[model samples]
Target: MKLFSLKKTFFLIIVLLGLTATSFAISNDALRQQLKLFSETLSYINANYIEVPDQKELIYGAIQGMLSSLDPHSAFMKPETYQDFQTDTRGEFGGLGIQIAVRDRVLTIIAPIEDTPAYEAGLKAGDRIIRVEGETTEGMSVMDAIKVLRGEPGTDVTITIWREGLNVGKDFTITRDIIKVNSVRSKRYGDIGYIRISNFNENTSRELRNELDKLEKKPIQGVVLDLRNNPGGLLSQAIEVASAFIEPGKLIVYTEGRTATRNELSARRFDDKDRDYPMVVLVNQGSASASEIVSGALQDYQRAIVMGTTTFGKASVQTVIPLSDGSGMRLTTAEYFTPKGRAIQDVGIVPDIKVRSGKVVSDESSMDRVSPSAVPEHLMSDSEELDSDNGAPEDDLQLLRALDVLKALNAFGGTYSRN
Candidate 1:
C-alpha cells in the first residue's frame, strides 16, 4: 500500500546510462520519424472511431497492450489493482481466503491459510472449484475466479467443488470474512517447538527468531517448520530464515537473469548462532518461491527433514521496476535454483515424507477445536504460550504428522544441541 519514490531513481539511472554509453546513442532523425508516426496514428484513431474515446483510457490501453506482450508477471496495475495485491499478500482480503491455482483448466485449492474463513469452511488441499455462486468456472481465468469469490465480509458465497472419489459435487456456502493471515504461529507442543509459517513476509524472519528464542530457554526437543500454505515473499527474508539453521558459507540460493546485473546471492560465512537446532520443514503444493528457496536449500544441505507433498514450483524472481508514473511493473527477471544447483521452475522439491491433507469437510464438527487452556502445563513453558485455538485441527493432518516425527526425533535425542 506504500507508494515507492522511484521516479527520481529511474531518472538518475537513465542519466548514468547516458553518460556511460558512448556509441549507443538515440539518433535525433530516427526519434523525429517515430514521433511523426505516433502523431499520425493518434490522429487517425481520433478521426475515425465508432465511439468517443477517453485520452486517459487510450494511454492506459496502450500501456496494457505493451505489457501484455511481455511476460505474465509484467502487468500494468491501476490504483485498485495495487490494492488487490496488498490485500492478497497481507492475507487480509475479504473473501473465502482459499488460495487457488489453475492447472489443466481446473481451479485447485492450494493449502488454505490457518484460521481463515476458507479453512473454517473445510476446504481441503486438492479440492477443485467447479462452480461459484451458481456460475460454472469451466473456462475462467484464475484471476476472474478469484474476483468472483471475494466480496463484503459477512456475505455468503456458495462454491461447488469436486474432490477425488466423490461422485457428487460438494457445495459449500462460505461466509466472507476480513481474513487476517497470522504469518507465524509458534508454541511448544510437548518437547518440540511447533512453528507454522503461513507465508514468508517482511516480518517472518524476526517472528521466527523471536519464537525460537522463546523455545530455546525451555526444555525444547526440536522444531517443526510448517511451510505448507506459504506462497512466499521477499527473497531477503527467505535467505535470512535459511541461514538460521544452515551452516555459514553455504549456498542458499542463486538467481540468473538475462542481464549480469541481477545475478547472484549466497549464504553468509558464520551463521553459527542459530545453527544447532534439528528442524523438520513441512511443505506442500502451495509452498513456493522464497519458501522453496529456504526449504530446498535446507533439504539439499540435510539441515532439515522436509515433510508433505512436493512444493508449488515457482522459481522465478520478480524485479519491480517503477516507471516515471506512480505505477510499476513487476517483471520476472530471473530463474532461481536451489543450493545444490537444482532448477525449481515447474519442478518443486520432493519432501522426505509425503502426507495429504485429506478430504474437505462442510461444517465445524470435523475440527477438533482445542482451546488455549487445553494445552497441558507440560506442553507450555514460562517463555512459551499457546494460541487460543487449534487451527484446522482436522485438515492440518500434514502438520500433525510432522509434529509426530519431531516428537519421535526428540525421543531419540536427535534434536540438535550444541556442546
Candidate 2:
C-alpha cells in the first residue's frame, strides 16, 4: 500500500511541473513577439518619416501616446514641464492661473484662480478653449495647452474661447503673471463666521486654523465654509481640513488602487476648542478632488449641510511617478470614496440644499440657464467674475441660501432642520 501511494504522489508532481513549464513557455513566446513588433514599428517610423525625427523626441512621443490612451489626466511630462508641475504644487508659478482639463475631447476651463490674470480676464468655468495663439486646440492635450498658455510673467497669450450663449468665439489676450495663491480667507457675516478655501495647498490647513482662531474670538453662532470654484490640491491637506471639524479616528476618505490594498484615511487630530456650531458648506461644479473629499465627509457625518449646486466629479487620486529622466508622469493610481463608501467619480456629490449661484453656466443642459436678471448685481458681466478676498460673492443667491440654512439650525438650538 505504501509503494502504491508513493507512485501516485510522484505522478501528480510530474503533472504539475509539466503544466508550469507549458504556461511559462507560452508567456515567454507572447512577450518576445510583442517586443519584436514594437521594435519593427519604431524602425519603420525612423526610416520612412519625411524628416529624421530625433530619437529622444520619438521615444517621448511614444510614451505620451501610451499614457494619453489611459486617461485625460495621465500624461508624460517633459523635464521643464515636470519642473513647472512641482512648482505649481508649492502654490506659486508663472502662468495664466487657470486650471484646465480635457473634457469630451475639448480643452475646458475647470476654474480660474481668484485675482489671477485668467480670472481678471473673465475666463469662466465651462468655457471651451478652441484656439491658443491662433493655433487650433483640436487635438491638444491638457498639458500641451498649459505649456502654450504659460510663459514668462508679463508675456501675453491670445486664447479663443467658445462660450455657451455665444455663437461666435471670442478672443481674450491675457498677460501671464506669477500666481501666488492664498488658499484661505475669512470674514464675519454678522454672527456667522464665513471661511473660503480657494485651493487645498500645503499651507491650507494652517491658514484655515489661523483664520478660525480669529473668528472664534467673537460670538460666532454658525459657520459657512465656501468651496466654490476650488479645483482641489493636496490630499493630506484635505484630511487635515476635515479633521478640524470631525472627531478623531473617524474615517474621512478612503482610496482603492489596482496594486495597493484599500486604505482608509481617518481624522487623527481634533480641536477641543473648536466650535460645534451648525455648519454649512457651499459647493458648485468647480469644486473638485480634495474639495469634494472635505464636503463629502462632512455631509456623510451630518456635521454640515452642503448647499449649492452639485460638485465637480473628480474623485481619482493621482500619483506622480518620477521617471529615470528628470521628467515625471501624473498617473491616476486610485479612486477615492467618502466614509460611507460612496464613489464621487463622474457623479458628483448632490447638495443637501440645491441653490443656484447664477454665475456659472452649467454644461448639463440649457434648462440650467439663469436669466441675466437673476444673476447677482456684482456678477453681471459678459466675462467671468472674480470672487472677493473673502471668497463669497456680493449678493450671491447660493450664499443667501446657505446663511438661511445655518440660521435655521441655530434657531433650532443647534439641531439640523431639513425641510
Q: Which candidate is the best by lDDT?
A: 2
lDDT by residue (13-63, candidate 1, tens digit) is: 346445534355655776647545655665565556666556556666666
Off by over 4 Å in 1: 1-50, 53-72, 86-93, 100-109, 126-151, 156-173, 260-262, 267-272, 323-326, 357-419
Q: Rate the local accuracy (lDDT) of all candidates.
A: 0.71, 0.83
Residue 295, candidate 2: how far off, in angstroms?
0.4
User: In candidate 2, which residue pairs get closer than 3 Å at backbone N, Cα or C atoms, i.e. clash?
Assistant: none
lDDT of 2 by residue, 1-419 (tens): 64455445445534644575567675676665765576567656655767755666866887898888988888889998887778777888899988888878889887888899999999987789999989999978877888889999999999999999999999999999999999999987666789999898889989999999998887787889999999898999999999999988999999999988999999977566655888999999888889999999999998999999898788887789888789989898999999999999888889988988864333656567778788655334311321322444445878867766665565546576444
**Considering only N, C-alpha and C atoms within 3 Å, which residue pairs clash in candidate 1?**
249-268
Which residue ranges in model 2 land beyond 4 Å of their true spot?
Answer: 1-35, 359-394, 417-419
Model 1 TM-score (2 dp): 0.69
lDDT of 2 at 410: 58
Q: In angstroms, give how far residue 351 of model 2 lies from its true place.
A: 0.7
User: TM-score for all predictions?
Assistant: 0.69, 0.83
The TM-score of candidate 2 is 0.83
